[model samples]
Structures are given as structure tokens and as C-alpha cells.
Target: MFTVTPEAQKEVSVFFEGKEVQPIRIFIHGGGCGGPMVAMALDEEKDNDVRFDIGGIPYVVEKDLFEAGKPFEVAFNGMGFAVNSSLQLEAGGGGCSGCSSSGSCGC
Candidate 1:
């Protein structure tokens, strides 16, 4: 399951109000140097996606890529919103050479 902090919910609400339909929050995995990455976006719904609500906002994850054991959190940082995985370092497999432990990769 995933959770959205109160601040994040407010941020998302403000961001999506002008968009068509309800925005769908996408959680993408596996794309960095170490092979897994985290990416977020709002887009139209796609087939085979898992849709859920957090604080009344719509969120989606690719069904095939979804891991039942993963823990996730969404929060707001200033004007931006961020998502985090609560999995251990080992569960992340390994750090990307271009990605700092903080999850910022210049690459």
C-alpha cells in the first residue's frame, strides 16, 4: 500500500485541478544504472494498471511491476511532491553509480 501525506495531498490537488479528468499518479521502477529507478507522472489511465486512492487522489501502478511487499510514501517538499520507498538498501539491489544515496543522479 502507499500513503500520501496531508501536505502531498494538498499539493496534488492543486496541481491536478486544471487538468482533464482526475490525474493518475504513476510509479515507475527499474531504469537507472543499478537497474531500478523511481519516476512519477500524471497521465491518462492505461489498461492493466492498478488504480487506488490516497486522500481522494487517484494513483496508479503497473500491475506487472507492482510488488506487494513494497512500502511507499508521498510527501510534499516546498512546492514539489516526492515519493519514497521504505524498502531497505538491500531491497533496492544496489545503488546506481550515478545516483547518490539521496536518490539524486546527475546522469
Candidate 2:
């Protein structure tokens, strides 16, 4: 129940060079300063996941998580990707980590 913007698809294709990308898995993480955020990674299809083909890329989302994150969109933010879940995910500015003046709290 999510859409992947063309730019996002192009980025994903570049990530895998189009021929070797694996099924992508979407997940939630609590590392960013804003709090819990959505992320994606290459993953094998799992029994608990429901497959979705978006922009010709294969994606697998855990059934329960998918239900909770419907009406979402995956977009490319030029430098990277973003997942927008109808405002459930807010923009968490980048460079808010180590090596940057902003430390642990990202402030």
C-alpha cells in the first residue's frame, strides 16, 4: 500500500546497478534525533512478509507493519531516500551524528 516515486526508483536501481538488487525490506529504527524512523535494507523474502512490486523493484514488508504503514510513500531526497507515512514520519535532518559538531542528542 505504498508508492515509490520515480526518483526513488532510479536511486534504488543505481544502488544495485539494476541487475543485482535484492528484495528490499522496510523497517523502523530509533536512532535519529527525532525518534523512531523508517529505513530500508536489502533482505531475502521472509515468510512473514508480503511482497510488493513498486517501480519494478521488489519489496517485502512484514504483514503487520504494512498494515500500520499503509498510504505511505518512498521518495528520493536527492542525497538519499525518505519514507513518508502520511506525516507519521517527519523530516529528520542529516549530519546529526558523529563527526559533526552536533553530538549524541543531535542538537
Candidate 3:
């Protein structure tokens, strides 16, 4: 299962406060060149999504994308909050073959 770090949760809570709707997190499981990659966004919840609490913030994931071995973590980089993936989607010795651009692997 995925988990949101305390720092990320705090940021999200502050950001969504007083908004009309609760912020929704989306996990898009396809991008880049490898056919299936990872993407995330914040928006209204979708119909086929599952809701869960992480570090007190609400998170949503597509039903199909919710797998048994998910290793997700929510953290803050220098600028803002971000979700990190534990699943290594790299491809090949040098780097990801599907990742055409440097550090552009959409995993």
C-alpha cells in the first residue's frame, strides 16, 4: 500500500483547507515510452477510484492500479510535496531504454 509522509500530509492539509471540495490524488499508470508508467495529480475524485487516508490526508487511486505490492511514499522536495515510487521501472544497464530523455523516466 502507499503511504503519505507527515510532511506531505501537513502540506496537503494546509493547501486544501477552506476549499469547496476535498483534494483528490490520482495515480495514472501509463506514460513515457515503456507503455505503462506513473503519473500523479490532484483534482476531484473519479468514479472508479478508491479512497484512503494517509497521514490524515485523503488519497485516491484507480481501482485497477491498486496492487498488492505498492510501495508509494509521499514526501516534500525542495519546492513542494511529491509522491515517490518504490517500484523500480528502470530498463537496462545504462538506464531506462524507454526513458528517451535524461531523468525523464515517468516512473
Q: Which digits, one per residue and each the tens of the lDDT, describe model 2 over residues 1-107?
A: 67899999988878777377689888776545555677788889999998888766898878888888886678998878888774375535554544345556644
lDDT of 1 at 28: 56
Pick out the ten consecutive residues of candidate 3 with the lowest summed lDDT: 87-96
Candidate 1 C-alpha RMSD relative to the actual structure: 4.4
lDDT of 3 at 27: 67
- Please, what is the TM-score per model? 0.63, 0.75, 0.60
Error of 3 at 86 (Å): 3.5
Candidate 1 residue spans exceeding 4 A from truth? 29-36, 87-107
Rate residue 19 of model 1 by lDDT: 70
Best by lDDT: 2
Candidate 1 per-residue C-alpha lDDT over 22-79 given as tens digits, one digit per residue, 9 for 90 to 100 = 7465565556555644557867667877777776677877775556425667778895
Candidate 2 displacement at residue 25 in angstroms: 0.7
* lDDT of every model, 2 decimals: 0.65, 0.76, 0.64
- Pairs in clash, predicted candidate 1: none
Cα RMSD to native, each candidate?
A: 4.4, 4.5, 4.5
In what order do the candidates fall by lDDT, top score first? 2, 1, 3
User: Backbone collision count in every prediction?
Assistant: 0, 0, 0
